[model samples]
Target chain A: MLYTVLPLEEVLEGIEQEPGPTVQLTLGGITVEAEPLGNFQARVVRVLSTDPRHFLEPHCQPGFLIHGQIV
Target chain B: MFEQPEAEQLPEREAPGLQTIKELGQTVTPGGPLAEEMPFHCLTIIGQIEGHLVLPPRNKTTKYEHVIPQLVAIEQNPKIKGLLVVLNTVGGDIEAGLAIAEMLKTMTTPVVSLVLGGGHSIGAPIAVAADHSLISETATMTIHPIRLSGLVIGVPQTYEYLDKMQERVIRFIVQHSRIPEETLREMMFRTGELVRDVGTVLVGSEAVRAGLIDEVGGVGTALNRLSQLVAQREGGMH
Candidate 1:
């Protein structure tokens, strides 16, 4: 159970908001799982790799836009 | 010439350094990697403390595993004179929050917690576990009873652990801070204070008045108090 000061409404806000169309692609050698913004641009969901350094990459930070081919 | 070709061939290797220069206009590099380190290990517990379960990708969560080890490292590290826990959280799993609060209370290292925005629910216990607790002028805290989530199938015995869970939170907070059990309980059951829930929301100085937080101040006040504790401990050792 969430023991927070925030209202229940705020806590559960985006739970059902959107069923995001997510995709996995490689960008800058890191396996990035992202949601496509357009043909070549996508917003990063997460950097799916074992390398901790890859996760620390600013470009791979969640919500960061990535530009690359859909592979 | 070989090094130049390698760097040119691999653009990904240069991204971090190139972006650092673009933003901060400097590079610490390998020679000064520890230059960015500070005497005080500032640990922030923000967002929702989601415990073991990984929340959605968009959810900003402070997971249990993410912080518990840091507390251990801070205790072992000689260079870290004190710990500054900056909290702006909408509390999460009771087990996770209490584990953190218990560790904070037991650690030999001096701790000062600063509450900004809000340190509600389980955050309350963690805040008070510190040597000194400070709250930002506009920050808030919520005092509410712990209730079980999900289904309760058959017997009345289902609530047995729930009662114990709540007791842990209350026992920890009261032991760590000056807030009396009666006062905390009254606040928890104050139905009129909250529109829908049975609870009270303490804003800044109200928390101090309730004896849950030590002072109505922010980052500067917390740091000053922490340094004083560190100095006092060092002097005692000497």
Candidate 2:
């Protein structure tokens, strides 16, 4: 699975209205749930996997989500 | 009955000369006027300078953590009339040394640097960082290229990255000191100076001749120059 990282502000600007509990991000087909996580800030953080079409065999370890916030 | 105890009984060892072990300790105390008043406002010395966090064993270099706060403190304190920078460093981390040099370049207070034992590598920038620089007639300075320590990728991208970093150092040194970029580059890449290294080793008078240092003098000359600069600045203010 491929992932995309983007700044929170950029993601918000692209979305028309307040996203729901699970908002589908535009870059690198990523669907993140706002309910499960907290609000995004000005920095870039890894959200979820990118587009489903390109999603290959899951090479990542199970039971853990790769998420990173900019320092 | 004892046939005069053999001479072996005359003490096997000569009196051990007064073995004196001197342990010099540095004490930390709260700031006070007594601490603030001194002949020289502040003395900044770069003992050993290697341009990285983890230094070589037996390597002597200045630690940025130790020098940074001192520079900031000296700048903010109005009581500090002069700063004396003593350089006896071999120059380690370029960024760290340059950070220190940049701070010294911008300091409002007068600064004088005296290169003692040896000021080489990034020490070149530090030696010239002050308003007036001095060196002992026997001291030496080495002008060398940027060196990498740990594992480094050898791809084109890696080379590009290193080139950019080197450029940053060169730009900073040129901006702060009188040495021109071309001359510095020539010195940095000069071959056969060090047995296995590609740099130029300049002795005392040579360093001054190369425009890397101001004059050939020791502590007294350095302090005198700093005092003069301080007096001039203060006089202008009054």
- Measured by DockQ, the strongest candidate is 1
Chain B TM-score by candidate, in order shown: 0.87, 0.79
lDDT, candidate 2, B57-171, per-residue tens: 3433355654665676677667667889887775556678777888888888898888888876667777678899888999988776665434677788877777787787778
lDDT (10s digit) by residue, model 1, range B31-83: 56565657897888989987754455466787665467568767877888999
Residue B167 CA displacement from its true place in model 2, Å = 1.6
TM-score of candidate 2 against the unseen true structure = 0.63
Candidate 1 Cα misplacement greater than 4 A, ranges: A7-71, B1-36
For each candidate in turn, give its C-alpha RMSD to the true structure in angstroms: 6.6, 22.0
Q: Which candidate is the best by lDDT?
A: 1
Chain B TM-score against the true chain B, candidate 2? 0.79
**Candidate 1 local lDDT, residue B227:** 89
Question: What TM-score does prediction 1 earn?
Answer: 0.74
Report lDDT (Cα) of residue B105, candidate 1. Answer: 90
